[model samples]
Target: MPTPSRIEHDAFGPVEIPSDRYWGAQTQRALGLFEIGEERFPAALIRAFGLQKYAAARANAQCGVLAPELASAIEKAAIELREGRWDDHFPLTIWQTGSGTQTNMNANEVIANRANQLLGQPLGTKTPVHPNDHVNRSQSSNDSFPTVMHVAAAIEVNGRLRPALDQLRSALAERSQAFADVLKVARTHLMDAVPMTMGQTFGTFAHQVSNALARMDDALPRLLVLPQGGTAAGTGLNAPAGFDGFFCATLSEVTGLPFVPSPHKFEGMAAHDALVELSGALNTIATSLLKIAIDIRFLASGPRCGLGELRIPDDGLTSSIMPGKRNPTIAEVLVQACFQVIGNHQTITIANASGNFELNVAKPVLVYNLLQSLRVLADSASVFARRCVRGIDVDREQLTTNVERSLLAVTALNPILGYDRVAQITATALRDRVTPRAAAIALGFLDGDEYDRLVQHPVNCLINYPTVNRAAGA
Candidate 1:
């Protein structure tokens, strides 16, 4: 085995970095250590790391950690990194980088090299503006990392999730109006319940989506309350007296995100309750979306072999071996992502609860799970809207057929025919394979005019049955 060559610069001096390794041995080692999943942190996260560093550089200049010239140099280097210059440095496999220390170091090394370059100095150099000493001065892993996490999630939610949700909401609203006249058999536990307009079904989706969007919006404030000033712990240790407020203000100015200092610094630095709580809100939205996806997919299942209530635009093979079968791939992914978000929530809860004080050791696990959750929710929202919600077309004829065939409609007969007689009529209709009207007539439960009146256009009977009417009354 040979020692790998290191990236050296005149400023920070020589670092014993591996030459043969694609990233570094440490990153490779971390990858081996944390073999979690196929789901990588979204690229948005890496870009956000750049944003934080960029903001920090500016703040560093203002705080006198670096003069304007050095700040400008560091800023230019950070912009390159932000524009995707040093993605290789982030190669520390997720496993060994618990708490994202490796990610922090990756940022440090990349910025150091880049800054050294801007200064017309050798690479790996940390002189004029050290990556950690000056560039990352007054900041700690606990603060900067979580700050990036919040910013990343906020950007995703604002730019991606909200737009996708708005699209879904609009689709549902359109469908509701379109489906207003189509009455169908509603199901509770997959059993025939009663009459509900197709429009009402779509309206339910819109309502749920509204709730989800509200939940997602609520998470913003919590996420905004970051620990940027809390260096290493609750106390702003090496930070200047007014640095905390100034640092937050600087972040706000750079990112356009309202980065407010937390009231409880100790709790903020020590616990990830904020992450878990905000993630839980995201999971709640995911859960709502899960229901939306399931209902849409089930409705769009089939024109023959399945519950063919609606038809979705086909894309590709959702199943491997099943020919002519178009699986609800988008809905499936949305539901699966919901499960993942929930699972990540559990991991975050367990991790946060495990810590004693001053720091949660599961920082990497927490942030990793959080990033996963944000990506899943963002991706799933688009999928659900684009693949399922937008392209849907109701099978109006099938809906009518299902509604007409349902013996549950005999409840309309109950008001005039009475429960006992209607029950007998229903049983007889089922046994004799005749219509409920026929059974009612044979049993002499009601005369022709009365039976005709009861089953006439749905609303007549509903008006007679006050309980059912009140329940379904629009």
Candidate 2:
């Protein structure tokens, strides 16, 4: 038979918890009470929690509040957690207490158990490294949870998201330069309107992503201001006088993130406006990515029926019945990922507004959505860069054909021939379904020699307008 369950008692009542589990009464209680979702916190968050506890233990020990041995044990255990050991031990879901109190306790209990084991103490014994007093000496769940959110988000954006975006931008820039001279018909309102180089179009995509990355950087300062010192209600109630400063400095040292104590702990604890701003940046990025992905799909729409300006990478998955159908699989995946990020942004926005007087009751959902958005964007950006943008092949034949076929090419002749003449040429070209060059000559708008001289090169008409000496011609 299984080992008999152990009874743990908290303020509320006694509950039977698994003896083998590292979590204590509060976490056990939460596990039993909240079965809302299967979505647990990711390893990044767990590592962040470890970092927070480790910094706290080190700072508390340095401040002479925690015993040296206990602090050392907690620090070691936190390191293990930070290095991703025993990640599965953190079993609390993201649907726990709004303040993330349960997950915080979950971290506290796991660290306490591991530390106790290191000192030859048995599991569930909260002595030597008591979860609340020693491990969480100068911090509260209110502050620690939010601090970890910032820590995790900062690390991800700096280490993963930014680099991923940079790679994607580089890929797009490479394509832009490679296709610099590949002219194509420009579309406005989904109709042929003008002419532009493929390079110019891709360059705009690169700039949009670059701007989004800058926005993420701009929001970093706000995220770096942490709420670690704000214990119960942002008043530093049970924490020592200099605990905030020491904690921030120690955490910064530990994580390499420039974390500073929030001057107004109330704002940090009560409102997640910094996260909201970051989410807004992420939303903008998703919007840009959505546009980029959709544009790719549109350009690679059909080899026979639609604008086949691009050739998508053949992912080897052909349609079962259609014989040969190469889908824009990578672009579609990026598009779907961006859609999720956008929806997650809406969730974050609504959750951010749920902040009450001195505390926000939407911490779990806000952090959940924030992390999800970051992960999705980073992954999507990488895939898009490597599989989509890098492998993209320009359909030069289609591009050239469309450029010559477009009626808007007639606009370049306006400066030399006058707007009335150009407009008449365009109308006739559209109605007769002929090239503007053919239409102009057919309509007797210009002599064959003059028309030939003016429309000497289609590319020059689109990009480099010839300096037509109308006075000489007239």
Best-performing candidate as measured by TM-score:
2
State the lDDT of candidate 1 residue by residue for 1-474, as single tens digits.
787475643333433555533233334444556676554555777777777777777776777766788778767777776787676567654454335666765676577667776778754445665666766777887777777777777777777777887777777767776666677788999888777777777777777777777787887788788777777877878766666677678767766778787877777767777778778887788788788888888887776888898888787775578778677787888899999998988888887787666776677677778878877777777777776777778887898788767677778767665788778987898899887778878888777777777776574333233221222223
Number of clashes in every candidate structure? 11, 0
Relative to the unseen true structure, what is the Cα RMSD of model 1?
Answer: 4.4
Best-matching candidate per lDDT: 2
Residue-level lDDT of model 2, residues 179-235, one tens digit each, is 777898889999997778787777778777777778889998888888888998999
State TM-scores per candidate.
0.87, 0.94
The runs of at least 3 residues in candidate 1 whose Cα sits more than 4 Å from the true structure, single-residue gaps closed, are 1-14, 18-41, 318-323, 460-474
The window of 10 residues in a row where model 2 has the poorest summed lDDT is 465-474
What TM-score should be assigned to candidate 2? 0.94
lDDT against the true structure, each candidate: 0.72, 0.85
Q: In model 1, how large is the Cα lDDT of residue 67?
A: 79
